[model samples]
Target chain A: MDLATVTARLLKLATKVSDEVGSIISNPELDARMDRVPANLGPYGVDPFGFDPEYLKKCMGMVSWIYHNYFRCQVFGVANVPEGRCLLVGNHSGQLPFDAAMVSTAVFLEREPPRFVRSMIERFVPDTPFISTFMARCGQILGTPENCRRVLSNGDAILVFPEGVGGLNKTWRDRYRLQEFGQGFMRLAIETASPIVPVAVIGAEEQAPTFINAKFIGKLFGVPAFPITPTNPLLPVVGLLPYPTRYRIYFGKPLQFTGDANDEDEVILKKVDEVKATMQAMIDDGLAAREHVFW
Target chain B: MRILITGIAGRLGRRVANRLRRNHEVIGIDRRPCPALPTDIVHHRVDIRRRPAEDVFRHAKIDAVIHLGIIHNFRIPAEQLHARNVMGTETLLKYVSKYNVKKLVLLSSGDVYGASAENSQFIDEDVPLMASQRFPEIRALVAVDRMVQSFFWRHHDIETVILRPTFIVGPNVRNAPSKYFRLRVIPTLMGFDPMVQLLHEDDLLRMLDASLKPGLRGVFNLAGTAPVPLSRILKILGKPTIPVPAPIARALLERAWKYRLTSFPAPELDHIRYNTVLDTSRAKEVLGIEPERSLYEILEPFRAEDQADYTD
Candidate 1:
């Protein structure tokens, strides 16, 4: 079998095994870390998964394969990601979640011992058995505020796209301009007292120029939104795969929120805007440096 | 005396500075620092989107303002355009009103009329403005005009005047026609002999000068006396005039836009293709301003300079 087929099959088998054994391997100490935490603090509880170095390596291997064969992405400022609980806030690009994958690779490769991202999974992913099992084993949880707080409090680095679906839905016409961000991540960061590191990813938007999002079709397919691309509809099978695009991942210095966690909503909103502005500048600088959509 | 000019380094700002500097000190603010202007004119670099107008104006002992700063391109997204033009204007107006500025001379556009083939004839100041229906850079001018007018009329202290000029042109023109000139491409002349009306930079300055004088209020069209054929202007610029069908031209333009090869075509081009024209009777009668240079006269000297420079 070719490398891709072998890798895909291995990933499937590994995920199945990990999911079946994950509950048994759960550490009691990690669960007890949340014993004294307020139940009404948020809608979720701390569900910490131990970070296995080998699993992280395997994940990085997958990332390397995808980057070489598909994206050929280059990442920078990977050193800025702290080893402990931190918020990775990045400007969302492309309709697909390629930016997330690139960042995940960067963190894994650049971290001293290599680390895995405590990411938020979409609710729909869990419906598919293989995808859910894989994501769960990988330690990516649902994107609720409660989950974010739990992850951060457990000393795990969490990545959140503050702009949420709006950022992903933006078209080529509105490239680099940030859509309005949700304030939940900011609130979580403030409450957890985690440092927010702004990341900007360029060239993802050009990989598959998602110009339209047909809601009706997306609903029927049980996906978030059906991304309508210029090539995809016309080319079918090959079109679904993102065009190989060079990528630049920039990491801005971490911003600390010194204010009280229970600060007024207006104050938190201002802080959120400040972080958004910093991310926007990074995006603008990234775009200015590159000549083509891919590069 | 302190005066705030939003686009202080712009053509009209320069003219207004020259004309008014003798009496009142003009404080100019723009996105870039203006080191070229005279030392006496205090300049501030600011982005209208984020910077608070109160913070900028509170420092100055400002008396009045000539709010000229705006994104003229209609191809930009509506939010961006609104943020820069509509919101920027509103912020400045609100701040100036709060601080009790003496007067405001708002530079509006003749495109506010929502020009079309039906309104090709001499459109007056009272002509109803059609709502901007185009995507991304829709017409928010009428709303802007109403907002400015209401602020002045309803508010207690501030005085305001609005000058709507048609295709203001001069050496410093950085927009549409100049951009086309820079690209060395003739903009598609959609099979219609549409009359083009333009106000020379000097003439626009003259209108601003009139508005600055006491007792000027309400909207006025500031356009040249006569309109000329767009085809004739294209020929003057040395661009090979190709009469491609409008559909093909649009398709090519769209492709160019996708690749970021060229600036998106202005919504006004749609009106231009359909032979939309503007009336300048108000500018003539009320402001006592007449366009000094015709399109041919303006281009002739530039064309000669260009030929000499290239040959040398």
Candidate 2:
């Protein structure tokens, strides 16, 4: 057979596998929840940013299972996420971005008329293999002001981790402390007049329990940081898997602000601090209420 | 109105000529001769940088000029190609200004807005032309686009419309999109499926026709259907693609390009790796130019035949 025939057959088989796996992971309730989120798909069943709801649904089964069984997530105040355009500004933790995933999953599951939260990923993410296209298909876009503005104007919910890599690569010593936030999201919120929903993800900071951020090593590998955790380095690949800590996701009431988007940095930072202070308060509250990390 | 179209021998140029010839007097200039030219349309065989190109404008009272003669042949030496494109455009702009040409339409590609991870979903005309930063081969195109933009502001009386359309794909067009899709088994970056926009040649012809209207002048980003993933586009065409890792693919393509085995430049791989979608709101609002063809209609020509031999 020609290469085309062989490749086509392989693709067909791969799709079949994903379809079977998807059926196993997907339940009627989860399907209904996904249906609530309106999809602005084109003729070929893809959104303008290449988000394919069908593809997302098929892969949701595994992610859903992880959300329910693995992490055993407890989501609160999901209704606080407004029906229209809003930004879910949250803390960036869990070196691998499992926090973003769990938070998005919680909203997708708990909210009535489920809102598919599009998270702005790191710039280097689009350069990575498999993860790049996979993330786009799953409704995540590159974090640019323009992208955020576009999605916000389209009345879609967006999740932003303003701390970016700062909070993500934090050692266990710095856990629960809020990192300095970037002011870009605040400007976009002001420009688009979208509400900011401060999200506090409690358990993610303890998942990896990083001992040190090997910056020099990371520079050699051309990554942001080389996170050395308890299980990693010794166990190699398998050790990199995060501990199954119980996830507590808190979605705060939507905060609204108005002003010139192009205002001075100090002016923008003041507004950004409001959102940051709210998140830190929420995080502290969630930590006090939680019984244990590994429930 | 008498319209002078450069690069008329090219597929898009010929299509534009045929569409415009019905109402306006069509005059074409190209180094290559158009074999089956209609009897009514006048054809001139000369390079835009040459004296004969100026002589045509010096004699005929040309009302409008469609500048499409910019060369995109990477096989040619960079210096020679750059001179031909930039110098040719400079010469044409001078002639148009001197001869009192009232209208000018230059066909630019959306690729001037380089594909990058930092790019917005729909890049508007205001975004800087940064393609030359990564892909040095496209420096001439970016230079020409900037030159035309300055010309647009400098001459108020002359209506200058710069139409930066996305990848043009049609039956007759032999652009990078068309040529890549024509491959039996296309090689794609393993982890990258950036959203891409396609413009049907016919829709582009329509936009060209629409731009020739009396008063419409400004840079308009012409986009076809909504942006879709590269994988979905290939799936629609039923073409099997081999997913190669980005670095390896880049290395192999660079080697092949050096040996003249592949037409695609290694730098151009960024197009497939990151988003470069254009926002066409200005085109929709100002020029009232909307793409007429559907996604399926645009890909129909590239779709594989159902009964094609697979065993061979």
Q: For each candidate, report what fraction of the true interface contacts it reproduces.
A: 0.00, 0.85
lDDT of 1: 0.68
User: Which candidate number maximizes DockQ?
Assistant: 2
lDDT of each: 0.68, 0.89
Top candidate, metric TM-score: 2
* Per-residue error (Å), model 1, residue B174: 1.2
What DockQ values do the models have?
A: 0.00, 0.62
TM-score between model 2 and native: 0.93
Per-residue lDDT over A1-295 for candidate 2, one digit per residue giving the tens place of the 0 to 100 score: 9999999999999999887566657766667777778989887678988898878887788888888878999999998988989999999888889999898888888887778999998888887888888998999988888888999999999999888899999989999999989898899999999999999998999889899988998899898888899988789878878899999999999999999999999899999988889999999999999988899
- Per-model root-mean-square deviation over C-alphas: 25.4, 7.2
**What does DockQ come to for candidate 1?**
0.00
